[model samples]
Target: MRYISTRGKAPALGFEDVLLTGLATDGGLYVPESLPHFSLEEIRSWRGLSYSELAFKVMYPFVEDAVPADDFRSMLDDTYQVFAHDAVAPLVQLDTNEWVMELFRGPTLAFKDFALQLLGRLLDYVLEKRNQHVVIMGATSGDTGSAAIEGCRKCKHVDIFILHPHERVSEVQRRQMTTVTGDNIHNIAIRGNFDDCQRMVKASFGDQSFLGGKTQLAAVNSINWARIMAQIVYYFHASLALGGPDRSMAFSVPTGNFGDIFAGYLARQMGLPISQLVIATNRNDILHRFLSGNRYEQHQLEHTISPSMDIMVSSNFERLLFDLLGRNGDEVRSLLEEAQSGPVSIEDYRWKHMRKLFDSAAIDDDTTCAMIREIFEHNEYLLDPHTAIGVKAARLCRRDKAVPMITLGTAHPAKFPDAVARSGVVSQPSLPKHLSDLFEREERFTVLDHDLKTVQQFMAEHWKHA
Candidate 1:
């Protein structure tokens, strides 16, 4: 299948090329030229397939030209074999008509592992065949850095550098990124917020000289189409488990970079029997405001309990807006640039169009903590802060048609012990064996200012030096 850049200038590419090149040359995200659909019979025929088989079937249409069916299948199976859960993605009922889709059952204990694991395998397969080496750079608020580090560590031909805001991430989250001793894995603690780290990564991608070198530069952030594509599978898994394409469903996603829920949007375009998609946000509620018809404005970066969602500007939302305007890349680019002038005012007609397919809400720290405590008391279920935001938002904004609303549980609660403890929900949680002794290890990182030139210089010095 061929992919088109949301911004029209970049040349259309096959799936594997889009997978490897995170952002389009025109500064747009890549999307499938046309979404592949499944007939009811075809959907039902997947009943007895293993997770790997189902993944292969769902992803084949997109990557058919770039990867053979057998080789891709082998890579998928090998990747998922290491997941902590037999069912890599599981659905657990939270109420009579509400369920939480748990997506953290992987080595890193975060939803990102679902995609990064597969990406690591896919990259190795292609690089080995061509005898090429790549330098991967990523920005993370919390989970993505750790998951990327774990996924690509020790690979002979891949070097990964993850930059995160220093001291802003939780203690466990910080250790997860810093503890990796692999020769190919490196972590940088930038002296700023997640948005700054993300900007720097994008700046690196736009560096023409860097892009032309033998040492390839790519991204693992959701800006990468492969990450978004991998995440789209879970929506189908949840929908089918809860009677999708047969009964309508809704989703509550704890959104940060907007890649995860954008995948759900793709699922709807693929003809899944889904209703409105709900976007849940923490205090950094730029997305919430956008959906509410208020001007989309970025506020001062505030560190919240749901630190991963602590983003003001969401990159993947650009993909959605580009699609929403009927793939008018020029208009999308103008809107993106105009927002820098001040708050972005969406036209009423345009907002009405967006509101038809999407719902949104924001929850503050106190309410998030209360949701965790209340859910644990009522059902003995432990939820991390990000998932708590989704649960609370789902309950508040669900429409009558949104039956069996599914909120994505993005991370394991043990990742944030302080928040869980503050909520008064006592449950014994064990650390992964590798991280069991992390508290005793000496933490190390080089802190740098948020200047783009400083970051560029650092990358130049460290390129392939890891």
Candidate 2:
């Protein structure tokens, strides 16, 4: 599939080039020239396949140019080998019709691993094939850092550097990233919010000199379309298991960067009979404002119990807006600038169109805690802060009688032990094996100012001879 920039100026690129070159040179996100479709018959035909087999089917259209069939199948097989469950993403029914999709069964204990693990294998295959090196620069609110670090650490021909806001992430989140001692992995604790870390990464990418220098840079974030593609497979898997287009389903996603819900949107585009993509957010709810038509504004970050959703700007929103504007690049550009500069609103028709496909809601810290407590008390379901937000959102939206609502459980409860402990439910078997020893390790990280120049200098100095 040919990928075109959301902005008009850059030349269109193939899947491999778009995967390697993250953000477009023209300052746009890459989107497929045409969205692929799947018929109900075709979707039903995928029943009873293994996870890897289904993954290759769902992702083949988006990645066929970059990954050949044999190699892609091999990579998918290796990627899921370490998963705790045969079904990497499992569905659990919390109530009569409400379900929670548990997506934290991987090495890092978060949904980010759903994509990043395969990303690591894909990067390894591509680099080995071309005999090239790449330095992956990523900015994470919490889970993405550790998941990316875990995915890329100690791999040949790649150096991974992840920057996260210091004091903004939880202790567990910080330790998860910093405790790794791989020579090829570097972690930076930036003295600001996630927006600062994201800004620095973007600024570094925009640096022509840096791009022309020794290290070749790529992103493992959802900005790389491959990440979103990898995520889309699970939605198909979950929907098929639940009876798919023949039976409609709804999803409540605890969103921060908007990647997960965007995958749901992709599934809808692919002809799944999805009823609603409910977007669940914490205190920082720019997306809620947009969906409600109150105002779409970017503000200074606010720390929340769900630290991973503590984002002011939602990057993946651009891809959705691009589609909403009828692929009119000029309108998409104008809308983004307006939304960033101040509060802006798309026309009512546009919002109404979006509302038909999505429902948005927010839960504060107090409600998040209450939901966690209530779920455990009533249903014996233990949820972290992120999943608590999703559960609450799904409950709120269900008043409209949305059926088969599935809240995407973004991380394992043990990843946020404090929240789970506060919820008054202990694990039945206790934390998983990889996370069982987190309390025993010493956390280490280099603190840095929120300056792009400082980050560049650190990269240069630490990796000078690398």
* Per-residue C-alpha lDDT of model 1 across residues 108-220, encoded as one tens digit per residue: 88999989998888888777877888889999999999999888885678888899998899889998888777666778999999999998888778773644465768789
lDDT of 2 at 203: 72
TM-score per model over all chains? 0.96, 0.96
Error of 1 at 69 (Å): 0.5
Go through the candidates in order and give each one's C-alpha lDDT. Answer: 0.85, 0.85
Give, for candidate 1, the lowest lDDT window spanning 10 residues.
207-216
In terms of lDDT, model 2 sits at 0.85
Flag clash pairs in model 2: none
lDDT of 2 at 437: 81
TM-score of 2: 0.96
lDDT of 2 by residue, 1-466 (tens): 8999888778899987887888888778898998889999999999988888999888888888877899899989988887899888899988888889999998988999989998888888788888888888999999999999888885688888899998888777888898888777888999999988987877777673754476678898788888998999888888888887688889999999999999999998988888889999998999998897747898777887899999988889889988888888888888888776688887778888988888889999889989988888888778989999999999987644546888999998777766666555663325687777876887777899988888887887666244
